[model samples]
Target chain A: MHTSGSRIVRVGTSLAVPVRRRALVQGLAVVAALVAVGIATLTLGGLGIAPERLPAALIDIPGGSEGFVLKRLRGPRFVVAVATGAALGISGALFQTVTRNPLGSPDVIGLTAGAGAGAAAASLLLPGAVSVPAGAMLGAAGATVVVFVSTGRGFSSPSRLIIAGIGVSAMAVAFTQYVVMLQSRDQAAVLHAYLTGSLSARSWQNAAVIGGALAVLLPAAIALGRRLHLIEMGDELADALGGKAEQTRVWSIVVAIALSAAAVSVAGPIAFVSLTAPQITKRLSRTPGANVVLSALTGAFILAAADLCAQQVPVVEDLPVGVLTAGIGGLYLGYLLVREWKKGTV
Target chain B: MLVGSVLLLGAAVLAGLALGSNPIPLPEVIAALSGGGDAYTRTVVESRIPRTLQGLLVGACLALSGVLVQGITRNPLGDPGLLGVNIGASASVVTATAFFGLGGHATIWAALPGAFLAVGVVSLIGSGRGGATPVRLVLAGAVVSAVLSAYIQAMTLSLPDVFGSYRYWVVGSLAGGDTDTLLGVLPFAVAGLVLAVLMAAPLNALALGDTTAATLGANTTAIRIGGMLSATLLCAAATASAGPIAFIGLAVPHIVRALVGNDHRWQVPLGLVLGPVLLLTADVLGRVIARPQEIMVGVVTAFVGAPALLLAVRRMRAGT
Candidate 1:
């Protein structure tokens, strides 16, 4: 709960700047670190392109092996990872702030599980009838509606929302498994990769879909970020401050769902990125409220770095990036829980 | 209530044998049971006998462990699966297969040690300065489960050959196991059940909180350790025989508690019987729902168990 005091610079009647210099510097540093990791992800692989040539290789024509690897393989995968990570990061920040729960990510709240179930049903049950993304969206929306209606208290009570989410997640995962069981071996293999969130063989189209969704959703999230901070002061106070807490909450959730569904559809349901990204950003930036933009950058860095490790790690080459994130996230969650316990919160 | 549970269990077992991909007449099933039926009937009965036995042992062990866990932790949501025992066993088995090149049959042995290791870690981490609160225990278990499951996924995905077997084993079933596997794990299950029965009185005392239990002349730490050990043993044996089944442990105790108060004596026995009944019924339902294609019992239990979990949460919230 440490809050670095902000210096308020009063402009003319309508504008004001409340700046925290230290947090701003930290955020910039994180972004710079992310760029470094992005460069490493692009350059350090089996092909071993130098950092200097990676820029040209990415934009160059389709001729040599290096160009082929950059444009067709590594470039799209990296873009998809960045886009997916950003979407998950923003989504995590939105839900965590709106619910005022550190654990209130799409994965914890059952949205990812719902999206997985949707994708499974689409791919396994309906086959080619519906695209994976559409089915995922439908499923994510369905799960959100169910959770919203069933909890009755909305997102006010963190524990209740978490419990309901756990139940819903279990059922959704079971449904997905049942669908997988129903499919043939080959089809099940394909669905399995999607179920466990992978970036292997990702195309530019995959990157574009998530990128397009983020193009629309991230701006809305950023605009709502101030209101989200106000809502943290309780609904009554937020209302008195001219912030429509209810509307802001609902809009924040909608934006979160859109971002989460888009990310899941493109890269399946990557675990822990959404949950850890926002929390890490909040701590790193030393911000009083959810650091949405910084969280997006952190998430992009984490996922991209994890993807790089998954691909280039000697013993476990081409491992699904989700596995690495889930492993790391699980440890991070354990740490968070112990910290919460020591703080007497849990 | 005990009589009713026993009768329901009997009926469920009977239904499990009578209904399957190939249904047999009651007389023929009975004849097969009495060792007088034709080869076809005997074959069907024989295959089902092992599966039925597995279901009974696994279900009973899971339920007893669930009761013990809920009682000791004083957490309504406490279950062997939720506490990371099942995941630990699954992860151990996967690790054994991938690294040690162990055959599938030896997985149960690997599972026992792994389950204990996970349970120990969860208990240690969950216990804060004040003690392990319900929330801490559940959260610790969840975190541990997630970590282990990630490892499992990493291993399975890396080794496609392992994935082929791991997927089916992870889902948990009683179908593939034979009489020998059932016999092999029965001792551990029986020993665990006996230990659970022995600890029921201590558990009853422990439910009154550690201070009150100590005043009642109970060694709270000893009781807790014993309870945890027995629960871990039962869970490992069940998980080793049948992959990781969800909800039986979480839902059954609640259902049993609702039926016959929370006295460990009544709750323990009734849960033991009712556990198998619920599982067998779910297994039968799985078989019936998909005529030619069979759904795993684990999937059916999740569908049934999650609603029960939601209800439990509602009731807990309301009661509090």
Candidate 2:
């Protein structure tokens, strides 16, 4: 989806600047990229629109195309795509950094799997929380707790953490499938979209849920992410520098969970953005901070762009946005694997 | 261990045969198996045995494929299904069914060719000088899988009747028509198993990384081609027999690795044994728990594998 052959985004560079400044620059650049892409998404939709009138249409300046199409249709979808992309991308980055494994992200870390499990249970078994975000959160919390409990000794090594995450995520997948099988065949399609990830038939109501969740969660990640900066310096060093190793980890994880849950609830577990965005941001920033803000902006840009591409092929009526991203996510994962292979390192 | 696994498999197969929307007893099952019972015996023999065989073959294939793939990639963790073998097979079947208007045995035939094509495309795109480098293979597979899966989704949505009917098969299952599928694909399964076994020696050598393996007189090219051929054959045969059953590749190999460590020779065999054991057990549990309404085996396996994967990740973190 990213046309990797022609243009590989220049991310990793050893720019000579203070780590903090580098991150700020990267954040601004990614924001600029996202803004352009977001507008492009609004321009390219089901119905045709005149680019000259794009600004007028956006502001609803007296009969520019259709009011409902601009405000209600494309506007909400663009918002959801941007929000979901950013949330998933940063979430992936956070998990990868904390785990220290490139493969470690919300999807691989069991966050999405756990949330999917919860969503499936709500829809199939309970049905009360079928459309409720809280049910998904509850499920994610349970899975995260289980994941954290298993890693109680310490969360220093990235590889080990990912291995543990796989185990937890596998169970969630199984449980979700089990529930789907028990339900009538008619219900399986809806259940499957949650597991595989999708953003079809999204509306203002859906956007509100996602937007509302993001409002609470993104700020928390930003605040707690500062503490994570210290923790990443190594556990012993962090403790020596007056950081409470255990409490800080707990808080970061809580933040990670909030971000992951909100992302899953809104976007239905878009893949690898969370895992790849932060790494890309870090490379662009050349910093130790892991650039959460840059990750969010970059993620938003990626999703909005992908969403634009998806809308082009109206063959499926509603192309799954996650499917589009997963395509790229898989490629990015492969790229990491290739790098690891080439270096003879994992 | 083999005996225990076989017993568990037998018990699971019997339970699957006996338990369904309609229930039958132990005696009735015996009579049915011996060809002296009522319509139930014929049904069990014709339906259950083939279904069980499909499970057995696919499970063994997946477990073995997982071992082969992990060996080739040199990653303790690699999923053949994740590598898009299943996606390839599924996309092929969907094309045949929804687009080409194929069904029944014809659909199965279409699936085999489709599976082969998918495997061919993925391998061709993924393989390189380093003997199918793990990352390239993964990325290539990811692309192929996504493209094929997108086609599937598009087709399914368009052809509501075919796609709607294909729902059971899509999610992965072993409860559908068994006899024709079993008979049609048994040769492929047997051939695949033999091919996998044959790959043991070169794969063992390949485990020492490509350079050392080459230094040790291993034919890198032959080993890679053989390993890939076997993996594709196993997956294609298994998918043709049952629809693409998910996660056996991921879970069985992980369990086998835990039991036998990283030796492909030992790991492959262990995976073969344990894969059947796990699938059968899951099948049995599905039968018993759901009872009059049996849960699909694929769904059950996901339930079992997902948490186990999570647990493994958590433990690794703790150790780190």
Candidate 3:
């Protein structure tokens, strides 16, 4: 039942399960990196917290400047970044699995663009009628449907899906620009910052929403991962292997879309993390069947690290985290493309 | 067909002049153009002249560049904006303005080399062992554009002064074009156009695949390199003058192809004439669409062009 690189562990004959050694090791390493990033994020900033006092700051609500800085400012932003990043990671893994293409992450497939358009319209057009997050979720769902329908052959044709997504993204972006044009220059600037995905001034509610989304969808994503792997073997082969391929694909897409929408709603369509996280996780673990948990951990680490850099980098300090991710993750994607093309794998 | 396109271009130019937030009558527009209008009408007409010229130049450059790109790459979806050229120009302009303190016309020069660099990288990355396929080129373009956009965004966000001007420019508009910008980019546009027209016949040879093209006495390597260089120049010039307008380069070539069949000769000239027509029409539409508010031409073009892009994607055979 297990592949060459993985070993089966058995407590008894009936309880055998295959585990990938490298994936386990790399997953732990990613977790450790996440812890380090979290600590750095918590400690190093304009208000420097001593490493030893970080634990007490996390636990207590002392009525002082230190407490306010930790409990109010950095804490929630950190939580949102981690949770949003993890959601994006899991969402990306699901998308890559369902489409059978590494480049089919939600951001690349128009989910973020739709969410951005929705958020822009809701915030500007309706004003107080609907919350930005709710608008974003609606937009993401709408975009998913449009892309699916536009693909003509569904997820079976990954290329058409990606191209159709690009077309959808173009329209969505144009709509957002039209909305931005309606505002005054200063208002447009503020909207521009928000559209690029800023984490500045995030509250606890943002963290809670993304956290809840991850909690609700993470299990579904994991449960569907095995089936998605089967689906990648083609619909007939998957069905012959006793898996309902199309059903599994649809369900995986639903979970992925929900997770991505949740992240976009809170973070305003942060770029590139979703596209890169799963690929990075796959490369690191070297075991290739939708390493969902490891991908989530890797994503959390990347966003946390990116946010920390955004805060700490002097000349470019306080940059929207999305811009930073686009710079780094885009370069990484470019490298991946070059390498993939060189190997004739693309 | 070329004469009809030219006539259409004339009509578009007239419409662009006559229509705007402050709509001037056709007679007034003609009088103003001939330096015989009232002071207020003269000022309005004079201000719009640079914008119109920019629209025309940018449109022509983008269209010719699109023709060259599509012909050279043998890709139906080839476009300067889609191939990272516009963003390359934009990132260059931002860098020159922010880091080097280059302003106004100087950044136009900076944009050309930046565009060249970007197109060079994209072609290198895209070609691989099998030459540049549509999917690979498009993906490379997307990734390079993302990286460059991030750089531009970072620079603009960090520097408020750059942000003030960069925001409007990034959205792709003709509103900010002045006589100096039009003059600055005109030479580059003219040179790129000449190169493109000259390369069109070779591109036809290239359409038959490299080996066959070489045996037919066409230097495929020279054609590709010259065509790319021409495209970069056109893209840089257009982006410099009009701030990276999309879809003109993408949609114009396809429209020309539909009209003129597969001959690069007819496609190039037709695209040259029709490019400005499409751009001027989009620009005019933008002026009228939001009234005094003024939607940028880039926004209008994107709205108009997305459907065309979708159509192109749909027509593409599977496996690309």
Candidate 4:
């Protein structure tokens, strides 16, 4: 039978769950868009390959230029883009659900900037090549500790956390700029692109890194989603219901930090994807609570489409995907702010 | 308090003159100022004058803009740098430099309109159904700043020539200051300062909430417009002349407000004095701290101001 908001789905006698019909449709649509974008990414670039030859490219990975471009280049870049986007999306959903605030994403809370700063220090300052991902993870964890400690009341106070995050973000950005200034002009240009979160020249290694992170973290995020939703209701209710809000919040934050750090390490700190994805997905799905699956799909679609658009922009070669997302996502944030104000929700 | 700030200003000006990569002695600095030192020593000291003067003018403008913006918005977090004015100015300057080949003194012309447009956008988004809240305005400003910076990066990265000039400017330093640039931006800074002084009482009146201020015979609309206009002019001049220095505007008014009550008269003057004191001191430190290589004033201010910002955030009440 139909319920007010969600329909109860029955599978045999053991398990039944209520699912929102619109969320299911939107989720499928996002996945379809993602597939189309993936196909387009594979077909179009500096050197174009026809859509019909994509299957051939995959088969002849050791032989033709088309295969080299596809298997070695576009394929890995596309995979990293989707994986990191998905990672950012689920990370954002977890943070938003845990904080019970739409603005509570990795970027907003200084984690992304911290990761950027850490990566910058590793790349620019370390004598030889250092592990950029490890640096990013440490930076994200450091920001979390600072924000958590500075709040005094922990993450329960959303505004306080957000304010502390702004401070931390500012400091990290300054440090990043300082590091950038230390390099030669040519090196600085390259670092600048990387810092802005480019997907260009992404290797299979980068793809594997993000892919593995998503595989491990995404499932954990989804399983934790139910508890996070209950946590959003209130601490007392959640604890009374055996959800243990405090423990869930702490675990969710750790998972979120790892997901964002892995994405940042692979592609650098892409701006606003983590902030806008969950918000966009929630609005599209017309559902409450953390929809990690839907958000991840939306993020993958958004990043894939942005990277495709970035590649296609004429006269502006080597445009970073982060720049496009920053501009578009910022506009979205502005719109969200006005809408929330009008709705008296902010 | 005024006397104390003036004394601090004097000390900072001395530091600006005395400390540098060259490390002139205090006596040599005083002698160089009197035009009695050796030629090379005199040259170095003379070279420092433009930057010191630029620092004073830019710092005063930024601090005054901070007070006006905070007063008008009634938001403690209000600052020219935080509110996207500086980045907006950078965006316009970069666009002018890249597309129109405007360089040196001409970039100031591009900055004013951009700063004004940013102020307009921030107000439009920040103030609405229930008027502006501190968090809403800050978030709106951050969003605008991020977008503008993305545009700036896009322009800079695409053209190597633009990147060369932009990298230095974007770091927010007084290192590139010269007499011509100082002269170019001086009039706007003066105009803005005078306007800020003229708007003080009206701003104070409007602080009692718009309805109450309007009922008390204050022109809320005029006060609002005048305040933002003054802030925009000051911010543009400072950013155009010295690049986009952060924390001076945010920190100066805050420290000033803590010393003086909520009175705009006291805050405005003290901010004018303290702003330069902070900037010149930062410049001096940037010079001496790194030995042969110099850190930018922008980086130094961020280092100093970030902790202040965090402290402020920690001490913030439950809700504004």
Against the true structure, whose TM-score is highest?
A: 4
Ranking of candidates on TM-score, top first: 4, 1, 3, 2
lDDT of 2 by residue, B1-320 (tens): 55666676677667756765566787788788777877745675556666666677778887888788777766544777656778887877777777677777776787787777777776766665455666566656655666676567656554666655567576667777467777888788788889888888788888787789889998887887788788878877877777766677877777766666767777767778777767766776676786677777777777676566555554442334
TM value for model 3: 0.81
User: Taking the tens digit of each residue's C-alpha lDDT, what string does model 1 give over A155-178?
Assistant: 545556666776788788888877
* Clashing residue pairs found in predicted model 4: none
Candidate achieving the largest DockQ: 4
Select the stronger candidate by lDDT from 3 and 4.
Answer: 4
Q: What is the clash count for each candidate, in the order shown?
A: 0, 38, 0, 0
| Whole-model lDDT, model 1 | 0.81
What are the models' TM-scores? 0.81, 0.80, 0.81, 0.83
TM-score attained by model 4: 0.83
State, as a TM-score between 0 and 1, how close model 2 is to the true structure: 0.80
Q: In candidate 2, which residue ranges exceed 4 Å CA deviation? A: A1-30, A43-71, A126-137, A149-254, A275-291, A310-317, A327-346, B1-47, B219-222, B304-320
Model 3 score (lDDT): 0.81
lDDT of 3 at B256: 77
- Which structure is stronger by TM-score: 1 or 4? 4
lDDT of 4 by residue, A241-309 (tens): 998877887788778888988888788889888878987887666667889899999888878888888
lDDT of 3 at A53: 88
Question: After aligning candidate 4 to the native by TM-score, how far in Å is the CA of A289 from where it should be?
Answer: 4.8
